[model samples]
Target chain A: MNISSHRRTRDRVVTVLTYAAMVFVLLLPFALFVGLAVKSDLLFREHSLGDLLFSSVWRPSSGEFGFKPFIVGSVYVTLLAMLISCPICLLSAIHITQYAPTRVAKVVTTAIDILAGIPSVVYGVWGMVGVVPFVGKIAGWCGIQSNGYSILAGGIVLSIMVVPFILNILMEIYRTIPRELTEVSLSLGATRWETIRDVLNRKALPGILAAFGFGFARAFGETMAVLMVVGNVVKIPEGLFDPGYPLPALIANSFGELGSIPEIESALMFAALILLVVVLIFNATLRWLIIKAERY
Target chain B: MESNMNQGKEGRNIERPFAEGESIIRVDGLNLHAGKTHILKNINVEIPKNKLTVILGPSGCGKTTLLKCMNRLTDLTPDIKVSGNIYIGEQPVFGSKTDIVALRRKMGLLSQRPFPLPMNIYNNIAYGLKLRGKYTRAELNELVEYYLRQVNLWDEVKDRLRSPAVRLSIGQQQRLCLARGLAVNPDIILADEPTSALDPVSSEAIEKQFAALSKDYTLVMVTHVLRQARRIADYVIFMYLGEVIEMRPAQEFFDDPREEQTKKYLAGAFN
Candidate 1:
């Protein structure tokens, strides 16, 4: 009886500790959001939300802070990256899981792991050295003036960085599908490609969307690599070759210069808040879509 | 009986005299190895046309491997070496110029558990039809209904043909898988313990369907259950340790004592 009571007490203590840990994890994002909002309250009180979001003029000395250019830049670069990476990731993942020999697939998986493990700063330097010049040549061929750093360069580098992320997820999704399903399709006389197109791809569509969502979020918030190649100019980009500044770049580049200035600090905090909220919304929307897709 | 003497093995070769043009599939000296481990050893058998042939053995006896070799489903395994010839009619299964898709179309497979394709009920049947050729929507609808009714699932699922097939009960999903396989118009049906994952009533339903189907399609089934083999098998191939111990007509093989292994396996002495 004494031993039973002791066991019960230990179990209850462990349960309470786990619940406390879960609550702490659940409250972290809310705590961060509240802290950011409180710090940005001064800027919010001085400038209307619409003016702060939509106004293009961003002169910090005169207290004119506008986030429209950075917002547009983040969207353009992220979308371009996704457009380049999604097809490549999807096809390569299919090849790895469905067609490649086991040894070759293992080799390719290890290569992707190495790519994913590389530091982001290294990618930034590589982008500065290789991609910027390539983009400059393309711009020259297209009759546009560029000194290598541009949104296109940023997009190219971002796409390369996110390839491993998206491909790993896609390969895992394809692998998790039961082998029996594929054999069933084959036994039904469907060709291997037909089985992939008609059955396996359809089954993996929701997971594919989720993978793209994660890639998009990663690309949107990337700082050092994008800042290195994106030609951080304070204006809205007119085209792919033009220079622009994303939100993360803006906060990263200016945070050190705002010494003893509450207005500038609040504006930067507001940018961080916007970044967090947008990523949260994007992830939530993807979750909703995945759930809906699974229901059918 | 045109009996052939065994060359070196201890087992005797049982070569029953088959009627002319009766055998639909023949395996000659088939041997399979996964990596270095031999899975099937010198398998020689003939599956009769339009008959239910059950490959009965204990677990890991390569019964399913033998069935998979008929349709070349074993090719999916990695590092597996197969040295043998399997003939469906007069066509060689592993010929270099063989059209694998066409060969697969001639055989349908039912796995241990039901794997309804990730699609709606109607599309599950229609998918196979669509792969063969283009069909009008009306034709697709008619054929889907016909195949669903073939498996005795039409009345139960006719109301919600558009619903996802995964929503169905396990029994219904198995029936749907049958309907999907039958829609392709295969000449042979390979079932790998088709009723093992089913309840008793669903098992009976599947058994009745198989009995009905064997009149039109050749069936090669793998099962370890002696009662199930006794109940439905028209011909029995008893395998032990990757070798066929006896291949005989179901009634004769069960009644007469032939090999010691076959007798012990039949008398519930060993699995």
Candidate 2:
């Protein structure tokens, strides 16, 4: 082969090797998680397949199985996180996008960046000392059960943490709109608020909605902070203040409970599966919204 | 035109500028300064009623500034000072305590380039009406259709009134803007280089529409396009360096050009 063709072959070989390395990197954890989910033994040493998924006795000593309650608790907490975060994040995004002056937006946006950079563990600890008791008081006033480590507490803190992320992304979207459009509205005799509401908000709706979804996903898949704030009780939450077990928390909490290898793997694999699905759905929806926004 | 001119009995003759019922808009000793920059200096001209008056000048000649000042659009800016008065049909336009909104509603302003709002065709046409708080649902539909038809845009947009106004071609968007300006039902139309963005065919269409509109409404157009002015102007006001050098009937100004600047400008030797 000529030197040029030989070089092309080298480039092709490098490309294949790079892809193979990436696949090798990705496949390890994926296979581990999937294998743990399907493994029969709570301890993976002897048997490969087990019916731990359908069993009810979560006691690993007795070789009992099933994580139905844990799954329900995870879904409940994640959904609650969305309900709490979506509106607050979207409102702040609109405020920053439509109302905040340039300097104020810059300063406030930088503050949100700082917020995102704070450790999730710090949020968890802060919630333990700062947020749980306040939630308990609110729940007491509302005549709910007197537990502060409730799903509601976790969701609220998670919502606050994810708001900055959404606001930052959405500010960029608003900035992308042409200044001439706003000028046209003003020249038409529309007031500033009217211009924002009728023109800017409507134009930025899809991007704002995407921001909402992103905040929701971030709050939903959170682990350390949510686990700290969310009560690690093994039951479904009856209300905001009720004790609950999110999936990540269950994996974390139940790992110690498992005496055998199978039980630990089962919990980790189940939690990973749930999170992957949620993340995919969240991103897919956001992508669809971006496309829709561009078309209009 | 014959009745308006009078000759003085002297070795040196005198010329009269005004005619009976001809001074539709009169600006006297107008001076405008923005901070330290004096944009206009003693601008005085009486625009003829029911005529298509064209204001011609080079860039930064205060032609657009004067058009803006005609209806308080200039007042939308702050830190500006203006001396003297402007009268529209005997009413002082920028008079103290003038209702700014009311003043603007009576005049239509078409910007240099098309700016179609982020709305559908029907909504774009009805935007002004909605702001003015007039019309029921049926009435709004009727008014939108009427104005769109008047601007020759109804047939093309009737099927897609829900599509965004931005999707329209630039020429169509310009006409949509015209329709929007007309829907407000103003007495005078002010066009600031309205055809500069359009092709010759579109420019001709807009010129023809302006001619038709002049029968019902007064028009003051600011244009750099000499051919366009020569094609349709009834009255011509030439401004150089922020002052009106000459104002005359279109035939008199173009055929028998007088002031040195006007002569030079018309000859394409200078703007």
Candidate 3:
């Protein structure tokens, strides 16, 4: 009886510790949001939210701060990266899971894991050396003047960086589907490609969307690689060849000089808050979608 | 008993006559190896057209493996070597020039568990039909209804055609899978323990459907249940440890066994 009581006491303590850990994790994002909001209150009090968001001017000396260009840059570069990455990732994942031999698929997945583990700064360096020049050549062929560092260059690099993330999720989705489903389709006269296109792809659609959401969030908040190739020009880009500055780039570039300038710290804090909120919203929506998909 | 069984294995050629009806599928000297383990050893059998041919054996005896080889479904397994000649009608199964898709289209398969395509009930039936050729919406509707009725599922599902196929009970899902397979218009139907995952009622329903379907399609089934085999199998092929122990008409094989293994199996000596 005494030993059983002691064991019960230990179990209760462990349960309490687990709940405490979960609560701490659950509150971290809320704490970060509140801290950011409080710091940005100085800028919010001076400028209306709409003016701060929509105005295009960014003269810190005269106290004119606008986030429209950076917002557009983040959206444009992230969308460009997704457009470049989605089809390649989807097809590669299908091939690896459905067609490639076991040994070959294992090798390919290992390569993807290494790619995922590479440092972001290394990707930035590679982008400067390779992607910028390729984009410059493409711009020249298209009769546009570009100095190699532009949104297109950033997009190419960012797309390559997120390929592993998207492909990993897609491959996992395909693998979870029962082997029986594939055989049933095959025995019904469907080719391998037909089975993937009709049955497997349809089943994995929600997971594909969730993968794109994750890739989008990763590309949107990427700091070093996008900052390196995007040229960090504070203007709304007219086209793929034009220079632009995303929100993360703006905060990274100006964070060191924050105390010397009045209200600048608040503005940067506001930018961080915006990035956090957008990523949170996207992730929440994807979670809701996955749950709904599973229900049916 | 062991020596008698060895003699039965040695004298396989003289024990049973070839299937009396027109043979739809013939396997000659079929051998399969997965990695280093030999899964099927020198199988020779014939499936009669428009008959219920049940491959009976204990678990892990390659009954399902032999059934899968008929439709070339075994090709999906990795690191497996299949060296054999299988003929369906006049077409060689593994011939270099054979169209695998077309060959598979001629054979429908029912797995141990129901696997409905991830789609609405209507689309699940329509999927195979769409693969074959373009059909008008009216024609697709009529054909889907006809196949569903063939499995006796039309009345139960007529009102919920647009609902997801997975919403049905386990029994209904198996029937839906049957309808989906039949939609491809296969001449041969292969079932690998199709009722193993079902309750007794559902198993009975599926058995009734199989019995009815045998009048039109050449049905090959794998089952370990002796009672079920006795009830449904017009022809029987008994396998043990990757070898065909006996092949004969179901009545004769059950009533008068030629081999000690067959007699022992019939008397419930061992699974």
Cα lDDT of model 3 by residue, A17-121, tens digit: 999999999999999999999999999888999999999999887898999999999989999999999999999999999888899999999999999999999
User: lDDT order of candidates, best first?
Assistant: 1, 3, 2
Q: Which sections of candidate 3 miss by over 4 Å?
A: A1-3, A259-262, A291-296, B1-21, B268-271
Taken over the whole model, the C-alpha lDDT of each candidate is 0.90, 0.75, 0.89
Record all residue pairs in model 1 with backbone atoms less than 3 Å apart, i.e. clashing. Answer: none
Tens-place lDDT digits, model 1, residues A1-296: 36798899999999999999999999999999999999999998889999999999999999999999999999989999999999999999999998888999999999999999999999999999999999999999999999878889999999999999999999999999999899899988888898999899889989998999999999999999999999999899999999989999999999998836999999999999999999999999999999877843
TM-scores for every candidate against the unseen true structure? 0.96, 0.71, 0.94
Clashing pairs in 2: A40-A49, A40-A50, A42-A262, A42-A263, A43-A262, A55-A65
- Per-residue lDDT tens digits of candidate 3, residues B149-188? 9999999999999988889998999999999999999999
Give the top-scoring candidate (lDDT). Answer: 1
- With candidate 1 superimposed using the best TM-score fit, by how many Å does residue A18's alpha carbon deviate from the native? 1.2
Q: Which stretches of candidate 1 lie over 4 Å from their true place?
A: A1-3, B1-17, B269-271
C-alpha lDDT (0 to 100) for residue B67 of candidate 3: 88
Model 1 alpha-carbon miss at residue A149, Å = 0.3
**What is the docking quality class of candidate 1?**
medium
**Which candidate tops DockQ?**
1
Q: Comparing 1 and 3 by DockQ, which wins?
A: 1
